[model samples]
Structures are given as C-alpha cells and as structure tokens.
Target: MRHTRRRLTWRGTAFLVGAFAAACTLVNVVPHGTILERPFVVEGPVGETLDLSYAELTVTEVRTADTLESSFEQAVAGGTFLVVDATWRATDGYIVFAGAEVIDAEGRSFWATSRGGCAKGTNSQPGYAWRATYCFDVPRDALAGATLRLARGTHGEDDAGQRRDAVAVVDLGIGQHDVNELWDATEKISIEMPGFASAPATDAGGEG
Candidate 1:
C-alpha cells in the first residue's frame, strides 16, 4: 500500500508540472489583447490632412451642440452632440471607411452615433473626394481633450488583433473652457452631405 501511494503522488506532481508549462507557453505565444498586436495608428489634428497609406482624410470642422436641429426632424443630445465634418479621398480604388469613435481624456471610447440621419461611415471611390458628417452623443466630460479615430476597417476587423489596418486619429480640439461654453450654448448649424446626396438627408438646424 505504501509503495502504491508513493507512485500516485509522483504521478500527480508530474501532471501538475506539465499543465503549468503548457499554460505558460500559451500565455507567451498566443495573441491576446496585447497592445503589441494592435494595428499601427496615425494621428493628426483638426484641419490637417492625414494619410493612412490607402486613403487621405481631412477633419474639416468639429462642433458641440446641446441639441441638433433641422427642417424635418430634431434630435436632442443627452449631454452634447459632437458633430464632425470630414472628407475622404481614396488612393487605392474603392473602399469603405469603417471605424469611427471618440476617445476621451480618460481613455474611454464612444462609438459614433448614427442619429439625425448622419453618416456613420463614408464610402469612397478613386476619383473625387467624399464628404461625411459623424455625430457622437457623449457626456459633458467627454469633450475635453477628446480625439476622434477613423479606420479603414470596422471595429470587428481590428478587435481580433489579427489584421493589419490603417487608422487615423484626429484631435477634437475641445479645451476646458470650451466645454462649459458648449454645454450651455445652443447653435443652429447646418450640415450638408455632398458627393453622395442620395446617401441620406441630414439638415441639422433650427426652424427653416
């Protein structure tokens, strides 16, 4: 009996050691959510044209509003609506701009809001530039030091960390003082989508 017990103890110890080694190998070799696996990010500021290897993106205007107005429908912001005007010129044939979000100072990310018939993403061709307006409804605190990120692929394409993609990061240029001023003020801004007029009808402003 004593001999049998000793053999079982050695077997259990060996099994445990083997399991631990396998786990260690997986931790080192497998591609998890590590930053090393993410795609390369290109950053720029508002009004500056940026290249993402396959496309050229320009952030034209960034505005904050408490409420969005138009001739037909009105959409109000819970905290504020971040309206971003951007133009895209594709260099490598036709493609779709898939990723769009806002990253606040706290590293918190907010996806683009498709309300008010706004263009969540833009489709581009090789010929001319395409204009798009992305709206994000975020809290008051999200405006300060926020950055907008747009990528060639959708969020799912890059979230797996298996694809090599190009991303454009643009600064929203929202300052500390601007946050208060934006939250309290109501602006009647007009948004128009050209190059693709048939895409959607978005006219955000007060009564016509």
Candidate 2:
C-alpha cells in the first residue's frame, strides 16, 4: 500500500510539472503567436503629394453628393457619396493604381464606387500624369475625419504577401461646418475616366 501511494504521488507530481510547463509555454507563445500583421500605411492630406514607390499620388479635391450625374437613375447613394479627385504620376514602369478606400476615424473602411461615372481603377506610365475620380458611398457620419487610401496592388494581392507596396493615405479634411453643409446639400457630380492632365470638373462624364 505504501509503495502504491508513492507511485501515485510521483505520477501526480510529474503531471503537475507537465501542466506547469505547458502553462508557461502558453504564456510565452500566445502573445508572439497572436501578434497581428499590420499594414504599412503611409498618411498624407489633400493636395500633398505621396511617393508610393510605383506612383506619385495627390488628392486634389473631395466632394460629397446625394446624386451622381452620369448614372443619374441608379447612382443615388443610400447614405451619401464621397468623391475624390486625384492625380497620379507613375515613377517606375506602368503602374496601376487599383486599390482605393475611405477610412473613417473609427477604423471603418469604405471602398470606392464601382458605378456612376467613376473609373474602376487608373493606370499610368512613367513621365505622364493622369487624373481620375474615386467615389465612395458612405454614411453621413463617415464624412467627418475621413481619409482616402490608394494602393498600387489590390487588397487580395496584398493579403497574399505577393507585393509589399506603399499605400497613400490622404485626409479628406471635412470639418463640422463642411459636414453639415454636405449632408444637407444635394448635388450631381460627374466622374471622369483616367486621362493625362484632365480636369475632372469639366471632363466628359463616362457611364460608371
């Protein structure tokens, strides 16, 4: 009986030691294992140029709208539309500026409009400047402290770890007064296709 008790106590002690080692391993491994892979986001504001490796991007203007001109019928935004006019100058080879989104202060992201006279994406070659408009359908509250993000590759490609590229984050700079006015204002805006030095305000509208 004594021998049996000793054997059981030894087994219990061994099990306890194993459990303690496992707990220590979990405490050490969980933190490093759960570390998130954050994106390398570079920030800028409107009118400021960002050199995003493959291209140079400058957000010229940001407009809010309830209606869009070209697709006037189905182009109406549910909440409100955020239109961004940007100029791109490619530095390397022909670079395609595809990924775009508007990030709010609360870390909510809204993608650019795929409809209503807006270019789905823009591409430019070296030594040439191109202008395009990206429209995002966002809620009224998203207007305040919003930022426009542009990237060289698509979100999928970035996630696949295929390309480690630079992303341009431009602030919309919508103040409280501007937000109030934008929410109340109903305007029809036209988005232009990508072109060389094309003025978005006067450019011929394309069916988005």
What is every candidate's alpha-carbon RMSD to the true fold?
8.3, 8.1
Model 1 residue 58 distance off true place after TM-score fit, in angstroms: 0.4
Q: For model 2, what is the C-alpha lDDT against the true structure?
A: 0.75
The best candidate by TM-score is 1
- The residue-by-residue lDDT of candidate 2 on 113-195, one tens digit each, is 77888865788777666888888898988888888778876655333321445787788898766888988779988766667
lDDT of the structure predicted as candidate 1: 0.76
Candidate lDDT values, in order: 0.76, 0.75
Question: Alpha-carbon error at 95 in model 1, in Å?
Answer: 0.8
Among these predictions, the greatest lDDT belongs to: 1
Error of 1 at 131 (Å): 0.7
Off by over 4 Å in 2: 1-38, 71-74, 156-163, 198-208
lDDT of 1 by residue, 1-208 (tens): 3454455677899999999999999888887555556766789889887888888788888887766665556777777889998877778999888888888999888888766656678797765667788888899888899999887777663454224677888998889988888777687555554354221121232111
